[model samples]
Target: MSEEKERQAANEWKVGPVAFISLLVAILFFSGLFMKIDGMKWLSAFDFTTLGGTFGTMKEPAKNTFLGAGGVSAKAGFLFALSLVPTVMLALGCLEIFSHYGAIRAAHKLLTPFLKPLLGIPGLTGLALITDLQSTDAGAALSKELYDQKQITKKELVIMGAWQYSGAGLINNYFAIGSALFAALTAPVIIPLVLMFVLKFVGALFVRFVLNVVYKEDFRNEQ
Candidate 1:
């Protein structure tokens, strides 16, 4: 009976991880397709004359102000893309600060009790799971830490990979790039965002369901 339990646990671990990674890859590929089809050329279509006057013709505009005495340059589109750089840099810096302070560890402890049973993951796995929601790199780093500590098995890592891939760091991308596309195309911004969220939610649930089905016998034996 003990042997059967061990086997079942192992199988459950394997199924979850495998399904997670596959779903993540699919989401990324589709996101790329959506971006390409949404008309990204608007970034280069700004006209400075429409704003007020040509660049360098305006009086000194304060750094914080968008418009000058002559008017704002027709660089709205370019400026929007440029804005993403600072946001990304800020996110990376914040992540580093969080890691330095061991904030992830504290978060893990706080989340572990609730998540461990539901996800069938180790207490520390919470850190990686939450980080995955924020950013893929952060999640990957956390996963590696857990793996190195022997806190999670190969199967668990695979599941984390799948989950992170699906929509990890997606919020930033949506606001930065996706929003830009919506503005350019004059499309209903809420629709695409909602659709993407629904797809990701459904995909994650589907993957979890498949894992449960595939490993049901093993899980039952474990119980």
Candidate 2:
């Protein structure tokens, strides 16, 4: 490749050692892998669930959760959202630190190449995809902005939407909402989250393939 092309390629995939290290640290901290290591109980300091702590069990007959014990309506929904604030803030705060050291940039570099083959989308759309893990609304807004800016076609938006809609706000939602059911789960915390994330890819790819084949003529100009 030419010198200029080489430089551009280098820039495209640039992830410094510190950024990569930060990513690894963030993973280890949140993975729940070190929360119970025999004599190293202090490792809970690095664990998310351990540090985010648990809510008091509901004792108002049957005991499902602390959220009004299976209560319904807008009031119950508001309380449920209120309960999630602390954990979400704690998780996002730690993520912000990692991001300050460039974890997001590192993730973007590693994830960009898969966009085209996996989701039939541009590499630049990686941010919106990653953002969905934290906040569905932000990710949706970003995706819409991309479409409005003509960076991604309508077909690409639909495929991306399929991906996000399936698990929407995966990380935060899983930790905030799904964590309530963790007591009944036999598998570790990370396992189900991993499955959900993998399914997002599977779902998006299916949409992309359908768009290319069954709806081929509609996206004829997109190619």
Candidate 3:
């Protein structure tokens, strides 16, 4: 964590009820739950996926924009990743507004008690980690933003990457793809999700331990 950033945020905003509420709204906005509902499409207005929308198909339904269907290898991968640029930009824009109002600071303060102790990363990173549950691209973008702002150290960034990479976009990927195999599985659907979520923390902690023990000299100057 960057001490300067912490002090700056502390001076900029007082963590209060409004700040807390703002953080809640920001979290829900990216959580994907509100993107669609059985009978309530209006809620999509507040959802990140809905707000980000999707790329339009050209003549053929599968061929969207320059990236056509049945593509493979690195070229296809790059194009697929490129499509997420819009959502990432939009998420960062929204985050800036929330941060301006002190929601990000409040999130940092509120999550500090656990996040600092558990992962040794700044509490402000909670937003990014939570976002990963729904959108991997957005979470990664948020993490990059934090690093670019000099808010988290390189070690902290590595720890966060460990947490995120464990089950990147777990909720979205699981529910979307796993639902098809739900009937074939022996266990309940929620069980696997719970395990994977827990493992994200475990993986982060393990990485933290390794960094402290094996690579301590690399970050000797950092806190």
Q: Largest lDDT belongs to which candidate?
A: 3
- TM-score of each predicted structure versus truth: 0.43, 0.56, 0.86
lDDT of each: 0.51, 0.75, 0.88
Provide the lowest-lDDT 10-residue window in model 2: 60-69
Q: 137-217, model 2: which lDDT tens digit per residue?
A: 556766786688786899989999999999987887787789899999999999999999999999998888898899989
- Backbone steric clashes in candidate 2, count: 0
Error of 2 at 133 (Å): 9.1
Ranking by lDDT: 3, 2, 1
TM-score of 1: 0.43
Q: Which candidate ranks first by TM-score, i.e. highest?
A: 3
> Which pairs clash in the backbone of model 3?
none
RMSD to true structure for each model, in Å: 16.1, 6.7, 3.8
